[model samples]
Target chain A: MKNIPGDLKFLSSHEWARVESDGTITIGISDHAQDLLGDIVFVELPEVGQTLDAETDAAIVESVKAASDVYSPLSGEVMEVNSLLEDQPEIINTSPYEDGWFYKLTPSDLSELDNLLSPEDYSDVCED
Target chain B: MNKTPLYDAHIKLGAKMVNFSNWEMPISYSSLIEEHNAVRNAVGVFDVSHMSIFDFDGGDQVAFFEKIFANDVKKISKGNKAIYGALLNEKGGILDDLIIYNANDKFRLVSNCSTRNQNRQWFEKHAVEFGVKVIERSDMGILAIQGPEAMSKILAIKEIHAEANNLQSFGCMFDDDRLYAKTGYTGEDGLELIVPNMAINDLWDQALEVGCVPIGLGARDTLRLEAGLNLYGNDMTINNHPYESNLGWTIDMSDESRQFIGKDALLSIDQSKSQKIVGVILRDRGILRSGYEITHEQGKGEVLSGSFSPTLQSSIGLARVDQGYQENGKVFIRNKALNIEFVSPRFIRKVKMQP
Candidate 1:
């Protein structure tokens, strides 16, 4: 079974969002998503200040086999992007949940995280 | 989907499987880079049983093959030698790329699995006049043991070591029905063993016991790309000819007297108009993929196959560009023109394994 952090919420599409105490939310692909996309070589992160709608493409991760778009789980304005991924995209494969976080977003509404799947709900979705 | 004889073994070893040409095959086991490095630095095994094999025999077998394949069969009449060439249509467009092996009285052929049905129909249609019998041998499986220490692993098995060790590159030796050939798709010294279906699983187990880790199609593609090998469907299709696909050397044009299936059209086409296959390395921090536009000073082309080469630790690719492409070029990915360095179509040679 894949690791599903209890503190974070997930989208059915596999993005996970963790709300920071400062009201900003950190967004990254789930471990299940990174496992499916083996050996990520390139990542196209969204620019800071870019506005994104919920459940829309926010970034792209390219592996040798195929390229996949990372969806935004909540409507938000990008505050910070992961600049380390520019030279070392394989970090996503190593530490997908932590250091590999895609972007920091100031969510339009903090309650939007409630609409996403819980840890138990996301685990069931992965099994299906 | 069809499964190889070792499908269960792959599953047991935690391989990630995918559907390839209607066959459920392993695309990777541990990781693409690890498997690729294992083959380059040590030895690795690949299950290539999904490839289609055909056996042809008869008094007119040689004559039939000479007329069908672009490469000359007369050169391989001595037996136990394999020749790689293209099977083309009447218009000189590639139908498929195949390897033909002369096994004394009978000739053995292995071609792409995706084109199995079409290739069979093409062969049978042409075999009528020559009175040749084409038999599809799906009952056998193929395993490739490759890398620098590939022979060391095989030689450890005393039962077949003597014969396997003596075989020259592109040469084959048979022990009863099993054919072991010193040929491989990877740019390394190794063996491709063709064995009966029932015996394949046992052989795979033996190979694993001797420390040959299983590799998947993911690493297989990257390795072949780094080696500068051509993939049939991706690199060349029914719309491509040998001259443009960096396969002109395989065509037999020395003797116009010996007519082959696509010789006339191959000769009639203007070679000057065809784009040449060249290798390119990305100088920028981006990935180059197939169907990407490549623009040079003279004209534009398309990338046939591209990948992040594990050995070189950079993005590399093969592109078909106009004849005017020189040693320096650029490819347009995501509307950004990135500078590229041109190298030989072949990227890697056999890596020297440290003793």
Candidate 2:
């Protein structure tokens, strides 16, 4: 069974989101997503300052098996991007929730986090 | 989708299955890299029963093969020796690559399962003229036991033929009603066994009981790729000729009087225009993939097959570059062009010779 972090909210597509006190949301692929895509070789992060709508293609993660698009769970302007992934994509495979965060976004609306899946909901989604 | 004889076995082992050529096949038993290393460092078994095996029997068998195969059968007159070559169209395009085993009284030709039906039809179309009998052996199961310690492990297995220890590379022998050939796709010292369907389950159990891990097709590909082996549909197709696909060595141009299919077109084509297969290693970080562009100081080319080589722990690939290609090549991955080093297509060698 994959771990569904109780602290973070999730999208059905497997991206996890955590809203900071500053109202900025940090996003990354769920642990299940990283496990499915073993040995990630490249992570193409969204450029800082780019604006993205909810559920848009926000990043690209390529594993040895195949390439997958990381979707944004909420609409926001990219505040910070994970530049470390350019050389160390395997970090995502090893620590997908912590250092593997794709990008930080200052959400256009803070209320959008409530619309996303809760930990219990995301766990149920993964089960299916 | 079709299923192999070992489909249930793969599922029982928690293998991730995929649709390979309309057949339900296991792509990985564990992590792809772990399975890959198991074959490189130790022993592993692959269920390749999906491959098409055709048995030819008749006095005209040799004559039919000489006409059909690009390689000369005269080179393999003995029962054990096997000849690897291409079955070509009249225009010199590769219909399929196959290994023909000289079984003394008759011959057995093994080709890819992806082209099984087409190969059967082609053989039937030509067999009428030579009065050759072609029998497709779907009832046979093939297991490739490969790696550095593969031969020793097989020899230790009580159920396997003891005669397997004596078979040289490309040499085949029949013992206890099973054919064991000291041949493998991976650049390793091993044997590919063709066992009767009834004995397959027991043979698999015994191999595992003796410590042979079951490897899947995903590792089988990376292992072969790291060893500088070419994949059929990915590296070459009917559109590409043998000379451009690094299979020119398999063709026999000697014995000028002997005729093979596609010989005339091969002779008529300009050899100078052919692209040579070269190995590419990415200098920078990025995953190289098929259809990626390759630019060099002399010319341009395309990556036929590329992946993260677990043995080498880096990105590597086989690309077909235009003639006169030497050094200073770059592969375009995503939007960035990364510098690459070109090396001989063969990455690893078990010995000076295959045997």
Candidate 3:
């Protein structure tokens, strides 16, 4: 597989983030997290305008096998969630980086991205 | 841990491994949910060769099994079969649940993998008195092709459906040395093909190429649970009697003439005070798992087998509940309690072949 655009920031919690042109940021679970969760059947997204920290529970993803908590990628206010997940939860398991993007947020501070794992660093963690 | 013949194929397909009955077997390939759904909506093949297949040889084999098992073993003909039968002690305590294939005078038995050794010993102890032969066919391999498209897949490869219309549910076909039982743990239509050890690869290749995704024990548990089928160790055990485990129908207490192994003692069994098994569905958001405590308004219950039902879209379980506890009562899943309905084991989708 080609590189998953290393420019996107990563959280230790296995979430990936990319800043949007509107100054807001798009967020979703990393490919690794989705792979671990298996088939995602239900997703509970964060409400718009809900303030969340960089590393605290902000959403829920329940699969046919088990349920998991989706963490916020950056400390910011939630702007929008991918409502399509209500019917197409498996989309995350199939395409976590693209159609599976969960929500968007405006970063409290772009410097916090330093705490996130780079694509290389994230791959190493998953390898182990 | 021992690996089944399909271990390499499962591993190569990136199956998740788990320890089951001392064997390291694949629990699922890409996703447990997807593989699970495939079995429910379409069809899936399972590598169940780790389970023990015992062939009873020589004379009086039919008489021996009929005496030991609670099911009417005498009813099965050469090509027909019997359902899960109980080996009960004198007091009705279940020894083990197994299926007997009446391969003419010789019978081929498929038993629970975890109870393989114990079942073998029990069969041996009883065979001497009945004058029968018992040999463990450990060299045999079993592949269960189950679900709606099960018959189609097998017919596509082999002309095995000739016995479908005749081999009733829980029936078997003893073609040469192989045993094809119309039985499955999943509440789906399928055949459990027991082939010689050497034919495992060839049979597996044919089953897989015909669009049967290889399923694992994990899916097996989920599928059976959705169907409300009981697991041997979970739903019933030595400490519990067949009557108390809701297997009362299997006990042949009415056959006064047939002096079977456990008949005399079963007559004295006190069914009025037994804690019978019942099915439960969790009404809460929490996923119910095994070993969780259960308590109703009347008394306490224990979850025998529990999981998130992929088909039902809810958490379900089989529990040993107090007989007095109204079948419909509140179920305690972990610490949270939820009101669930009391129902029979007929929760699985109905298959055409099922009578």
Candidate 4:
């Protein structure tokens, strides 16, 4: 299993986001989330440019077993989506963090990142 | 939690374990969708040692089975076989679905894992008068190699005549020591092999050497759903009769001369209630899960089994809807609407079936 980068933030629901150098954020479900979901087959993301609040359903991750919503780590507007997931959704199972990146967003307020969990805090939250 | 003999093997492969039928089995290895699509596109093997197998020996075996079974197993020739026969209760409702293999010295019976003990109790209670010995072959291991290349992969390891008649659909035979049947719950071409428990690992190794991915229950459900096969407890139960479950053909009542258990209860009971089993292809952006309610403008029903069909690229499920609601066609998955299509129980596709 890949370790979450220290710089990224996590949600208790298992979504992770990295504040990119450009201030746009890279977002996806965490490795723990993908493992729990089994194999993802489809994905539904908020439209690009659609702003969302923290803790709101930003996207939907569908697996053969169940469908779970990916809550926004920080309030933002979806800027870009990784469309390759449309056909090969299983990439999320193999590499939930890197190649499996779901969407990119520009935070409405970068300060909202404080509400997210750091890698250490995220690991602690999942330990139970 | 219970564990099958393959438990250690699953753990060795880094499989994720989950509870199923009280037994902890691998829910996935690398990916459920990949494993599922592998079975659909090529070949995959599953350690189904969890299923129960029994051997019934005696001259009275056929007679006893005939009385308890709804299928006309007596009509099956020595080399032929019977599949999807209902072991019925007195009320004609399904006790369980079983397969009777016509063996040389005895008839081999395979029943559902969860219902095995209950079915055994029923069989024993009823078999005493018939003088048939119902021997539970619990020591044996059951493995299923399912997909397009399944049979050829197995045949290459050993020799199979593969005669058109012998390998015919639903036909089964014992090949030397192992019993290979062109039968499976998945709609794919495959064989369910029953061998001594000690030799399971070796067989699994051979199957793996031939490039069959080891699949788990997570993929198993998806593959079965893609094929549109009904799961036992989810699709039907003691409360739900066979007719309303869309399994009418499984009951062989054609020969009035044939007397099977539950015939009287079935014949006497009223099917006038508002229920019919149907299929739903989930159209919305969510996975339709089992036990989720299916709604229609006419009425509502419950999803018996639901999964994302790897082949169809959509969610598929079986449900029992009210007769009035079922007739109008469209079914609802959550708030999203899906078209309900009328269909027969899925058939075993040639490439995915083994005889």
Give all candidates' CA lDDT scores: 0.88, 0.85, 0.77, 0.77
Q: What's the candidate order when arranged by decreasing lDDT?
A: 1, 2, 3, 4
- How good is the docking of model 4, by CAPRI class? medium
**Interface RMSD after interface superposition, each candidate:** 0.9, 1.6, 3.1, 2.0
Stronger candidate by DockQ (1 vs 4): 1
Q: Model 4 misses residue A76 by how many Å?
A: 7.0
RMSD of 3: 4.4
Number of the predicted model whose TM-score against the real structure is largest:
1
Each candidate structure's TM-score, on Cα atoms with residue i matched to residue i, is: 0.96, 0.94, 0.79, 0.85
Model 3, B1-355: lDDT tens per residue?
8888878877887888888889998877867766788888888999998988888766687678777888766566444655567888776678788777765555678888898888889889989977777899988889999988888778787635466545657767677787887788888888888988788887888888899988977788888887777788888888777877777876654545777777777777778877877778776555555676777667777778776677887777788777777656766543556677666655684553222
Q: Write the residue-wise lDDT of candidate 1 on B114-173 in tens digits.
A: 999999999999998999988899999999999989999988755554778877778876
Residue range with the least summed lDDT across 10 consecutive positions in model 1 chain B: B346-355
Clashes of 1: 0
Which 10 residues in a row give candidate 4 chain A its minimum summed lDDT? A1-10
Instruction: Residues B256-305, candidate 2: write the lDDT tens digits.
Output: 88888899999987878888889998888777789999999889999998
What C-alpha lDDT, on a 0 to 100 scale, does residue B71 get in candidate 2? 88
Error of 1 at B287 (Å): 1.3
Go through the candidates in order and give each one's DockQ. 0.80, 0.58, 0.30, 0.55
lDDT of 2 by residue, A1-128 (tens): 46666789999999999988887899999888887787687878888999999988998888877778899999989999989888788899889889988999999987888889998898888889
The reply for model 1, stretches above 4 Å from the true place, is B351-355
